[model samples]
Target: GAGVSQTPSNKVTEKGKYVELRCDPISGHTALYWYRQSLGQGPEFLIYFQGTGAADDSGLPNDRFFAVRPEGSVSTLKIQRTERGDSAVYLCASSSRGWRTDTQYFGPGTRLTVL
Candidate 1:
């Protein structure tokens, strides 16, 4: 069985460009999360999905960042008008249950570079 995985392990784009980052969680996991890790900082929570709907998205920085778990399996993180400050490693995680105590398995992460 495959673990959590993200596409386009490295992405480079100009400022103000639109980008879509994809994540595929482990099969049968009900909890999914998206995080962003900036230089010298730990991964910061971006969004969480319990099923097909977003359970919490308070961590998203602004309107430019959005994520979706349409089928409760695969998710996509869409960024509009990307900025240089958006350059960071995007991470995805999954767990069997969406509880505070559940152990999360993380993906390798997608490194996004905005020029």
Candidate 2:
């Protein structure tokens, strides 16, 4: 019955460093999604995973962003060469069953600060 969770809650890094954020989806959920929210903006989908494979990764902004869900439950979002523009709250969500469901319960989010 555990909800999705993201680690660090907050992260601070230099403009060119690498950072990894973790997400633990709820038990029994088959769909997981990653979204990024900048200041005063709606969350934008980054990537999504159905079971252990990525169902949609078109939202990834560039080569600097990537994610994986190997075991079909826990996932990690990795960013390389982090830029100042990358500073934002990275949110993770999960839902029951499959892709048609839009009810993605969210975590408190991991706030990334790039300087």
Candidate 3:
């Protein structure tokens, strides 16, 4: 089975531009998550999706950030009106079941640079 994967390993965009980062989870995984990691810090939870609905999105910074897992497998993180502060390494992870103790497999992450 394939591991989690993220597309556009690196992204550079000017402030106010719109960008979409993608993630593909492991086959048969039913839970997906999106996180952001800034310099010198651990990954911060952004959103979590169980199946096609977002189970928890309280970690999203603001309305500018949104994510979806329509098919319960692939997900896309969309950023609107990007800001320099939004620059970070966007990580994606998935697990077989959405449990507090379930092991999550992480992707390499998409490094986003907002200029």
**Best TM-score among the predictions, by candidate number:** 3
lDDT by residue for model 3 (4-113), tens: 99999999999999999999999988999999999999999999999999999999999999998888889999999999999999999999998889999999999999
TM-score of each: 0.97, 0.96, 0.98
Give the per-residue lDDT digits (tens) of candidate 2, residues 3-109. Answer: 88889899999999999999998888899999999999999999989999998999999999999999999999999999999999999999987657468889889
- Candidate 1 residue lDDT tens string, 1-115: 8999999899999999999999999898999999999989999999999999998999999999999888889999999999999999999999998888998999999999999
**Prediction 2 global C-alpha lDDT:** 0.93
Alpha carbon lDDT of each predicted model: 0.96, 0.93, 0.96
Candidate 2 lDDT score at position 112: 100
Clashing residue pairs, backbone N/CA/C < 3 A, model 1: none
Q: How close is candidate 3 to the true structure, as a TM-score?
A: 0.98
In the predicted model 3, the residue pairs found to clash are none
Candidate 2 clashing pairs, residues 3+ apart or interchain: none
Give all candidate RMSDs, comma-separated.
0.7, 1.0, 0.6
Off by over 4 Å in 2: none
